[model samples]
Target: MPRTVAPARRHSARSRRLRLTAAFAVLVAVAGYLTVQYVTGGTSSDQCTVESADGSAGDGRTYRMSSEQAANAATISAVGTTRGMPERAVTIALATALQESGLRNIEHGDRDSLGLFQQRPSQGWGTEKQILDPVYSAGQFYEHLAEVPGYSRLPLTVAAQRVQRSGFPQAYAKHEPDAALLAAALTGRTPASLNCEPPRSTAGTGGMTKVRAALVRSFGKDVLPATDGAGAETPAAGAAAGALSVPVDTPLRSGKGGTAQRGWELAHWAVAQSEALGIDEVAYAGKTWESGSGWRTERKESGTTSIRIQLAR
Candidate 1:
């Protein structure tokens, strides 16, 4: 039996379907936007500042990254410098990491690539375990980078490409400016530079013990005194439970720029790690970086010999 349907009713049914389809598309788009924002750390309001020690007012550059990103970037730079690699090498490594992982230690990436540099175990970079370690992955990158002859003199992108063999070699160049700035401040070439503004109420766990462990992890055991009853001061004998004083040894101070430069390097590293390590204040070289105040000149006497880190209780 043929039943005639009204034209308006038929049009109304078609219009409803079209509207539903459009609504689904809009939902998909919004979901995609949110996923991208979360992955890219766009949802965080935290900021990181990197300025030249000599820069004038308003000359500093700022970037939006999670506290985790800042901490990982600091570690990458520290590993490079610890290996005696030059600032240029550190800059290249950092720029490559920035392009590959956005300075975050990602657990997954394109084709099984992992960690900050996206090194793949199947590709002989290292095991998944090794690649996931920021220090190990960073060291591996530098190891390969050193094999590139005259890498220091080569253009950053070319040098990095020789080691990374990235599908998009040219992309590294775009990150150079920011990477260089980070390297400058993190590698101790700039003083009183690099500040991370995390939330006011946030405090990390483990205090000074964790701080020492982290220092050893990044800077190596040499940075700390021998723990086996040598000249090292036990946790009980030194400052209070919440405070850790890191003596800036002569070897660290005897580098290219001497003590002043090395002092700031350690000082700045402590400040960079503040949020991650639950550090409440870091005082070094007559300047103090408190959790809320950033870096400021201290009116009280602050000896340049040691970096005093006071953890949040």
Candidate 2:
């Protein structure tokens, strides 16, 4: 003989099983989401990675950062290079920032220290507002750095410490390899080495005018000369309403690198600024990076001479 359960009791048992299954499904879903966030390092954008072409940055030969870090680094490099500071000088600046503030434009630090280099307003770095501006802070760093005699040839820590005068002077040395890798990519010495994922949402609607203004601010007015060869304002290269193109046939600032390097430099700059400027796509040197698609080679080649930026509408 077999014992038979009551109908109500069977129903209750089935309900318990159903509830457990649903709870397990919810747990799995949460675990999957967390794994994704851990892998991407953010909910909105992917991590930025710079690879060393020459096997630098230790055995890893790669450094990964959030897009925010990459943007600050790009600005630092731009400010340095536009001042005719060599790649070595950029490396030193980057190492100092890495040690001081992890290349982030943080507002608070020890006492009055602030900004990317942890500059202290009380120590005459700048007003509190100016020190918080990435471009201004970077410019101030380079200006002080250039005054250091033979800074380019000095040891990275020595040069950086002379400018920063940090409590942890030797700290800059450990960051040198990563800083060198970033400098090579950001300075356009290593083409296509720096790549960042676009943000999930457009940051603003400032469009082409805003983008051009940012370029002039970081790379100087020559980055988009007021006049083209025919003495007219250089027009957007595309017929689309939000398209802007930067001509890189020559170095925007007189410097050692050639036009190809200049092209990649502008292309990488646009990508670094994409989130801040609401850029949808950046195309240059036959490669295109889209908001969701990172960088990919175009089936049809885009010319290498001009960097094209498509603004997010």
Candidate 3:
């Protein structure tokens, strides 16, 4: 009186278990791939490149980042430049953001921390809304960094740690090279230096008004032409509804180059914002950068005193 199990039944159960285990392993692998894709903003093929326009191709220095990170980085640099902070400060801020949130305006982080800087609300960085605003968060970081004595002279890690008080203090050093490149291009120290190849799926229908508003928001209204009878055409009149021409009026100084540098800054900023604002073409300093096609030189009778941004219609 003992019950006997069939060999066929035992084999069938073992085969089913093996099949299930293999399926589960496949599922886990797919999930991990997807998570990484989401975190890195999909494939690495689409990227923003920052280089030295004046340097030889063999210079062997370039900074690459996702389009999203480039946008946030540009905003941070603009905030610092607009506030009259030096390029070094912008570099420090960019590095801090790179370490904290990878330059994404994230909504959640360790505990109640949020935004690009990962400032915690409980610690009075700001309320959730303020902390989430990249502009506000960048400003707050600068305000605190300025308080640190001789921050510019201190080692980057020491200076940033004084402001951020991050647990991993050494991490900031790793991002310095990329931060310097971004700071150079965004702060207008490099010409025709930053280019972004936005994903085709994210392109937007063009609007010049939004472009103008965005320029004001980042660089301040002073960057805009005076509305009252100035020699330059109004932002609305010089171009059609879908096109905008921004005049570069930063006064040229002896031995400091000419308006060309300022033109490049506005031009590069427009390119950086192309994805977010749905821009299609940006032309300045006799060079034009299309959404898909990188930068190219073109001769135009109109000269390089203003940057032309054409949005999709």
**Which number leads on TM-score?**
1
Query: Across residues 14-129, which tens digit of lDDT does each residue of candidate 1 receive?
Result: 99999999999877655643443356544555556678665647676645456777788888877887888888988999899988887878777666778888798999999999
Model 2 / residue 159 / CA error / Å: 0.4
lDDT of 2 by residue, 65-88 (tens): 877888899999988888888889
lDDT of 2: 0.79
TM-score of 3: 0.79
Model 1 root-mean-square deviation: 9.1
- Positional deviation of residue 263's Cα in model 1 after best superposition, in angstroms: 1.5
Candidate 2 collision pairs: none
Task: Please give the distance, in angstroms, between residue 251's alpha carbon in candidate 3 and its true position after superposition.
Answer: 7.7
Tell me the lDDT of model 3 at 164: 88
Question: For model 3, which pairs clash?
Answer: 206-312
Candidate 1 clashing pairs, residues 3+ apart or interchain: none
lDDT of 3 by residue, 217-264 (tens): 888877776665644446543566567778786532112535776677
After aligning candidate 1 to the native by TM-score, how far in Å is the CA of 262 from where it should be?
1.4
Q: What is candidate 2's CA lDDT for residue 310?
A: 87
- Judged by TM-score relative to the true structure, which candidate is superior, 1 or 3? 1
